[model samples]
Target: MKLPKKIKRYCPYCKKHTEHKISLVSTGGKRSALKHGSIERAKKRGRGRGLGNKGKWGSKPAVTKWKRKTKSTKKTNILYTCQECKKSHGQKKGKRTGKVQIENKEKKK
Candidate 1:
């Protein structure tokens, strides 16, 4: 599905309809550097105490470590800003729930 570059939605802060620009936000470069160092330290620590479970038993769940295959994006909220009111409101992505509809077919006798 193609995501909207700009979304028109209700802004509670502005109390009106607004257009929000959707873009991928990234952490500042400095923060990324800091995270890199922290991850390296964590890897080093894990190597010594078998914390990462890399070399542990391959088949056992107990030895398996949960790891994210993909890095998490910094996009936290869907931002809306009213053009007339010039006010903004942000809603977290997790707050929205999706619904799945199933169609039922009737049999003819």
Candidate 2:
């Protein structure tokens, strides 16, 4: 969806209204591989090696990668940076969208 690059919003730090910049917040980084209780760590410890039944870690029928189903859109967040205080804050809830664009200004209708 199209959005304005700058918006007049309430700035809690400044305790007043100010122009804020808009930007899309990207999804966070991947999880740590060495974290406890991870499948990789368990396999490295020889837990799933030479076992009759690996229980929860047991191998199952292989499925094609393309067969996996996932949501077309992702939950995205917007960051608003206050021009006065230079402080940034995100929305209370995320918006699900396939695409997001922050234009310099809204087109005249």
Candidate 3:
């Protein structure tokens, strides 16, 4: 899907409509293993002392590449930056597409 480089959108900070710049919002970075309530932190604290059926904690069979199914497309999210207030906001919903492209003008053929 193709998107415009700039679009007129509502700016909450300015409390009015204004011209905004469009840009893609990339996925967040990897999570930290030492964060609070994380499984890694619990394991590090010697808390793996359960003796009964581990259920989800039990080891599972390894999955092969062919056995695992993955989606070919990804959900693309965009951000709108208010030109007047210099503030950026994101849409509530994201678009699912194979690819997203933003351009100011069409190339001359």
Candidate 4:
């Protein structure tokens, strides 16, 4: 779906409506190993070498997986980046589609 590159929206920080840059918010990558790597290693060592405790995930029966299906439509995350303050905001479930195509829609007379 095509969308306006710049949109007039409420800016809480600026306390007024301003033109914000339209962009797709990407799903961030996983955290680096340095931060929580040590903690996870300590946990594994304390627990046994094998899968000490298979949580709810492993407890489920894998044979029942085929019952559920994936959704046809996916909600795209639209990010509104304020040009003035340079702050970004996320719109939850903005538009549902399998694919996203960003483009400015010109005003028609």
Candidate 5:
């Protein structure tokens, strides 16, 4: 399905509705590297005995057939900055805090 070019989303940091730029995230170089190298090795090793499934009864899922580990194909809206605070809140999924401010009550003797 064709996706929208821009979407109005609520930014928690901004605490209000903000315009988010929507674009398909291209697969990074790291994914290509893993697909071309390590993934191939894992698939080759996983097929033989001693790795697993030597005498197992259950059938393995077809999704596991792909040698390469697939990343999220869904499109996501990433916020570049906060609209209300006018701060650069990058698209990271963790709380970011600054150093605590301290006040000197008395001078050291």
Candidate 6:
């Protein structure tokens, strides 16, 4: 989806509405020390003592899928940085999309 490079919105730090620069909030780089990462490694090696099921209230599956799966599409979110105060506030969740673009006049052909 395409979004304006800048937006106008209420800035709590500025005490009024102001122009804000828009940017996509990234999911960030991978962390080897992630909680699930270590737990998965342990489960694979079969020391599965403490890492129980992380899902639903219904009856547990008869056969568990070791290869966890997730939705391909992720909900897009954005950050709006107030130009005056330089403070940022997270905008409401955006549409589900694989990518988002900041519409830039300079980059437009």
Candidate that scores best on TM-score = 2
Write down the TM-score for model 1.
0.34
Question: Model 4 clash pairs?
Answer: none
Query: Per-prediction TM-score, please?
Result: 0.34, 0.68, 0.63, 0.55, 0.31, 0.58
Of models 2 and 5, which has the larger lDDT? 2
Best model per lDDT? 2
For candidate 1, the lDDT comes to: 0.47
Cα lDDT, model 1, residue 93 = 57
**Native-to-model Cα distance after best TM-score fit, residue 88 in candidate 5, in Å:** 8.7
Decoy 3 TM-score against native: 0.63
Q: How close is candidate 5 to the true structure, as a TM-score?
A: 0.31
- Candidate 4 per-residue lDDT over residues 19-99, each given as its tens digit: 899898765655563365444454455533356453323434244564576787767888999999999888866677877
Q: What is candidate 3's lDDT per residue for 1-109, written digit by digit as tens?
A: 9998988889989999998999998866668868998666766776555686543333332345346868878888899999998999998888789989998874454
lDDT of 6 by residue, 3-92 (tens): 899877899888898989998887556567446646546556655345565342223432444355576677777989999989999856
lDDT of 1 by residue, 17-92 (tens): 6765544332235554336545445555553354455443322333235453344333344445565566655556
Q: Given candidate 4, what's the lDDT at residue 97? A: 81
Report the error of model 2 at residue 103, Å. 0.9
As for lDDT, the candidate ahead, 1 or 5, is 1
Clashing pairs in 3: none
Please give, for residues 15-97, the per-residue lDDT of candidate 2 as tens digits. Answer: 89998999888777768877999777887887666757666554642355346768889888899999988999988888888
Q: Where is the poorest 10-residue window by lDDT in model 1? A: 94-103
Q: Rate the local accuracy (lDDT) of all candidates.
A: 0.47, 0.81, 0.79, 0.71, 0.44, 0.71
Measured over all alpha carbons after superposition, the RMSD of each candidate to the real structure, in angstroms, is: 11.2, 4.9, 6.4, 6.8, 16.0, 8.3
Error of 3 at 3 (Å): 0.4
| lDDT of prediction 4 | 0.71
Point out the worst 10-residue segment of candidate 4 by lDDT.
52-61
Q: Tell me the lDDT of model 6 at 2.
A: 79
When summed lDDT is taken over every stretch of 10 residues in candidate 6, the lowest stretch is 54-63
